[model samples]
Target chain A: MRPLDTAYMWDLVPVIASYVPLTLFMAIVAMAAALTLGSALAIVRVLRVPVLDRIVAVFISFFRGTPLLVQLFLFYFGLPQVVPAMTGIDGVTAAIIGLTLHFSAYMAESIRGAILGVDRSQWEAAQSIGMTQGQLLRRIILPQAARTAAPTLMNYFIDMIKSTSLAFTLGVTEMMGAAQKEAAGSFLYLEAFLVVALFYWVIVETLSVGQRRLESSLGKAVAR
Target chain B: MSCQIEITGLVKRFGDNTVLNGIDLCLEPGERVAIIGPSGTGKSTILRCLNWLDKPDQGTIRMGDVTVDAARATKAQILALRRRTGFVFQNYALFANKTARGNITEGLTTVRGWSAEKAQAKADDILTQIGLADRGDSFPAAMSGGQQQRVGIGRAMALDADLMLFDEPTSALDPEWVGEVLDLIRRIADGRQTMLIVTHEMQFAREIADRVVFMEGGRIVEQGPPAQIFGNPQDDRTRAFLRRVG
Candidate 1:
């Protein structure tokens, strides 16, 4: 085995840190889009409106069943073939879209479960209070459901941060992509891979700390 | 501005099982009425129907100028009608995510378009009245059953609704805690808001209710003043039922 070069390894830190903003940019956009789309899907499922719910059910199943890598390829590679407009979009945009679609399906189910876990009597009580269905959901239901769904959403976001590494396959020069390029030139796969792993671990740990704070606040609101 | 409730020929059935069968009654404005009946006899169903929570098979519920044919009222009409009446559940169905104050003021701010400050002031007043003034910032699960129910009452009272509906409020409380909730209801009733209660506490009914409605087998077996019904019930079913429960 070759000897380790501590200075060479230390120099890669800033180079890798430069890609931090892009990785974070992708994750934040993906999380926001996923949450919005997921909320719509959750509401559709909860309302169970005739034909739309069936389509949403199928969409959720289809997205959740396949591997995220496969879905990413399908969106980045397969979609451009079907739609000429998508061909002009960059790899980062394609990856973000794919992440959003893939995770929103999972997030929707989490949100739906949270909404359903609320006591049945709440619906009756809201109705008895003369709240319209929309009013009931916006004012009464969503706030409670959000508390239960927040931890799950944060977990998905952490998964999404790791998942964004997969976007390097789509040719987006994100953190993982930058690492791969550096390792390929230097032939120092160990250092490059270790740096990427540390980056992911640190980011995930930060999110987990935030999640703990959220859980504590929710705890204060409801004893259990 | 009289706000009496007149329910007539109220019939609700789910498949072959009838929950309320042609039940008819008239409640004067500010009348403290208690409905007592066995399980599955639709005691709760009647209150639910009054608010159009469950559509009755046939009936008319008149609240002021609004008339709801529980059998056929439009969704919009029923929603409009329900605003005048506040319904409380046995489980104290407070919104779990909301602080006690939030739960109380939500309806006032949203439904009535009251300013947040005004609603908060009213909520504070009602919470104080219900003996939970200090617990306004607390959530439902953080409180006891009785305290939660008091918040629930404060929630309903925030509406300043004409007719408050209590569906077995004390039935869900611990034996020792039951009196606290009943006393709160009695005080609310004394303040002259019309209230219709469904209760199992015969003593509270006898003491606080201006009229007691005895229901058995989905129909009113007997209905009269508490003295006449609880002390001197006419129907054998009411007598036997009271004897068993008492």
Candidate 2:
């Protein structure tokens, strides 16, 4: 009912800022984990490895088809209920697992496309030089695929950073969670939410700059 | 070790469309054979089949001490056969992500177990030999098509394979640049390293090939010394193909 409190909004900035590291930490770790696991899934799908290919296809379809919020709840709430040993899993851990699984499904497809985008002649050329399949993959295929997939992967990381807000529902006091708690005590929900949005905006803007720099450098490497 | 190549009944099919049908070929060590054929007559397929890049539906291929039965070759046998030969593709097929030197040295260090220093030394020599010594650090995307194909040939040469297979080496080059690539290939031919080249350049083939094999409809319709195939011409198909291309 009262006019929006400018002073209270200013005070919420540092409180939310204090939790930025935790948000970043969750996103960074999740991004790294997702990259490794996603690349493996991409390779499996590309190679169409026997039973594992079907299993990975199903896994990707489920994670991609479902909502991340639901998946987070399944990891944080449902898993512990079904599996007693998982009771000890904390909100942060659950969030990381959720982000890794959900984003990896999407990332796997991007990486798979990148791998396929590499010319078929590259494989033949590598083989003609006596390279083993492993050598061809590690030295030739993955490097090119990584370059092709970098910008998209960076976009996914930014998305994952923002998605870290959902971790608050599981009781982890990250940036959004901190803001929500700040608003609950002060009854200044708009101010708290505005500050949180600003923080995400700055972080994403900074990353977009980095993404452009990376793409330009890669472009230069290939430029005539 | 001798690097003779003997292929018998090499048949390749893509579902109902057969690309290579019951081909037989023989090459004594150091022979330079140019395979000239119409598009889709399977000249490229023959080169690919030799390396098991395209698995022949039915065939037996022997290179040096390695023999591969296309239908049932073991993984080790296929690898062994591939190791004995190098292939230069039509489109230059240089690794886009690597510099010219990296493309040359990758197989040496990774597959042949050469130390980094040794591989670099060998690569440097190959770069110079291919007339791209200054472009060793340049990526394929940064080079002209001719330069990229030179790097492709350099990458193959760095492997020290006894046999080389070229599938239209200069076909993808610009008209002006094609001469430089063909010149480099001619130099390699003079070295007598044993080669099977599938090419469209009649003049280059006449200059470099000891033997010329004319293929049509997935079969070697005629083959003999370059003088006979180019000048005399035994089969009507060979005469017609040469007439069309020349």
Candidate 3:
């Protein structure tokens, strides 16, 4: 009502843009690490390897059931007390670790479902054709599973980007953290929060568009 | 090229019921054998057992020089035997995510260690032979049921095995489409690639089989040349099955 206050909003743009790379860095690293870890866990679970499956199941369930913020807090605040080596790890590393552990659990479930969705006859056919267990997975099973799980994995990446905002609580001065600092200094909470929200919206929309393209191309191989 | 298969004392049980009590079959080189029987007579189970997809509780399968003990063979020897005996499932079972080309080339390139270019060339040749050459780039779902089934045949051909096994290859196709698939299979048999087929298409088996075997309750009740097995049955079960399936 007081003339829109366009000047303050325009001035905060560059300051927020400076933190863009940090936010992206966290998201990309977390996504890569999560995919690798999650795929391994998914393979272990799907094979139903004896005692190890139960351990991985418990680990995935625990990470998936809890809030990402609580995970970040635990890694950043609580972990250092329990493990001494974690004391020297900075806030950024802590944030990455927290994001990876949180998203990997969700991705594991997606991967497991995709692997199982491939028809049972495929496995029998592969075995009948003399494929070793490793060969069956590498040549036949994983490629098909990857196609089915791509859309779900992309969804996790989008969530991971949004979840990076929680890193501010861990003392990492990412985009949201930078905004919070500026807001406190200038007493402009509404303006700073609005600008940060716009940045997140832009990133999420861009990712969704890219994800659609990937799904379409992969869908060609899968047919239906 | 030596093509001989000897299955002895084959026994398979699922829980309390025995699907295959004891099966012993012997075939000469380049034998085109057709196994005909009614449903639940374990015709399909014989093909599955021959490939070791379902292991027999006791017995030995000797294809060429390799011997597979259904009850006691190690995993490595079992795989070796399977590699030489190609199988085509009734459902086709083409890898859904792979193109017809990819489906044909996987075994050639992966297990046999052929280069990708060579594998692609082989796939192209086989697709042409199977009459699905134009559908190579297409996915399984994009093609009709007949085309997909043809690709299934190409998949087995690419393996270059001494013996091929078909378990009701045309049973899943629509009535009109069944002929196209059967025609392709008949052509393959004409080439004398050595095949064991389990089929409900009585006319097809009559035309292509060198030896016809009528199985009932996991045992071969009657077997001879098509003329004797199809025209004259020595067992009542075979006679009744022919009346019903006819």
Candidate 4:
């Protein structure tokens, strides 16, 4: 409040950077788990697999409709009270679970749209070659869908990286949490928050570059 | 190593609209049959039904040891039936994401369980046969329509299918590209590969088909040897259709 502390902000960069790995670690793990689970949910929705399809629909609806913060609290605090087995789970685990469930709901729709976007002729071509449904999906459909979904999925991963900031609410000392603690101890809230924000900006910008390169490569593959 | 095909009482409908009605057909091994018809007259539907791509509401299709009852074919039976056949789509439905060779090799490796080395070798041979040896690495989007269609044919041919069903193989081609695709089909016909082709090219059909069938209103109006059908048509409908097409 007195004045912006430039020297303290520069010093706070490394302190915040130390926690970047933890933040990235959470995001990476959550992204991987979300993609796997999301793909399964997408396939289920695409195929309309009886009762499981309805269950997945409900899961997607509930997770997408609710707030991620409430979901995190539910997983971290409410879960232990209701489920005895969850009582032993730590804050990091709860945050990861929340991120995966929340993001997977969004990711499932992206993947499903991508799968649907593949030309109908591709299905016919694969079937004409004697592929069973599973074989068609594995050998042909999923590969193409993954390509179409890649840019969107990459964007989702970037979003998840930023969303990892919310893990601080669960008391995990990721980048944002580290910044909060540093600011509280030194009364340099502006400097500490600014450093953490820069960390996220750099990470997102790097990923944006990667996303563009990925899209152009895919474009080349399909370019006339 | 070819097999005859017998299709009886084949019926297909989309909602209340019948696309095929009581179609009965028999093909001697290595016969080249061309189905000619108006756009909505079910010629393409018949070809699609042959491969079970568009399931028939009622009928039986017999190809060698595989007999699929339209009403009762299990998944395994359908797969078995399809394994013996190949389909060339109107739009040159080569896998868009794969190179020309990849499209050919995918079925070989994934369905037939051929080793990658064997599939690649076969795919290379097919690419050369289709006159696209240098374009094996080109994706469909990068190729001209004629080249893409040729690659599509090569993909089917690589399967060594006992029966090939071409659903308007050149219908989607530019006028300039049509001749090359027809020429390729002619070469395949010369090899005596059993084929059922749905086409609008009257001259090409006359030259390549052993038997020519004229279909309308979801029914075959007449079917005979190409010479008889083209030179001395007995059915008024066939004569009218041939004249219109011409």
Compared with the true structure, what per-residue lDDT tens digits does model 2 show for residues B9-102?
Answer: 9999999988888999989889999999899999999999888888888989998778888878998898888888888999988887789999
TM-score of model 3 (CA atoms): 0.93
Model 2's lDDT to the true fold? 0.91
Candidate 2 lDDT, A1-224, residue by residue in tens: 77878888888877888898999999999999999999999999998899999999999999999999999999998999989999999999999999999999999999999999999989888887777877888898998898889999999999999999999999999999999888899888888898999999999999999999989998776532
iRMSD of prediction 3: 1.2
C-alpha displacement of B153 in model 2, angstroms?
Answer: 1.0
By summed lDDT, the worst window of 10 consecutive residues in model 3 chain A runs over A215-224
lDDT of 3 by residue, B83-168 (tens): 98889989999887789999899888778889999999999999899888888989888888888888888898888887899999
| Interface CA root-mean-square deviation for model 2 | 1.8
- Listed for every candidate in order, the interface RMSD values in angstroms are 1.6, 1.8, 1.2, 1.6
Model 2 chain B weakest lDDT span, ten residues long: B1-10
Candidate 2, residue B118: CA error in Å?
1.2
lDDT of each: 0.88, 0.91, 0.89, 0.91
Ranking of predictions according to DockQ: 4, 2, 3, 1
**TM-score against truth, every candidate:** 0.93, 0.95, 0.93, 0.95
Please compute DockQ, using alpha carbons, for every candidate against the native two-chain complex: 0.59, 0.68, 0.64, 0.70
Chain B, per-candidate TM-score: 0.96, 0.97, 0.97, 0.97
> Can you write out model 4's per-residue Cα lDDT over B73-150, one digit (the tens) per residue?
998998988888989999987887789999999999999899999999999999889999899888888899999999
Query: Which ranges of candidate 2 are over 4 A from the true structure?
Result: B1-3
Q: Residue B145: error of model 3 in Å?
A: 1.5
Q: Which one wins on DockQ? A: 4
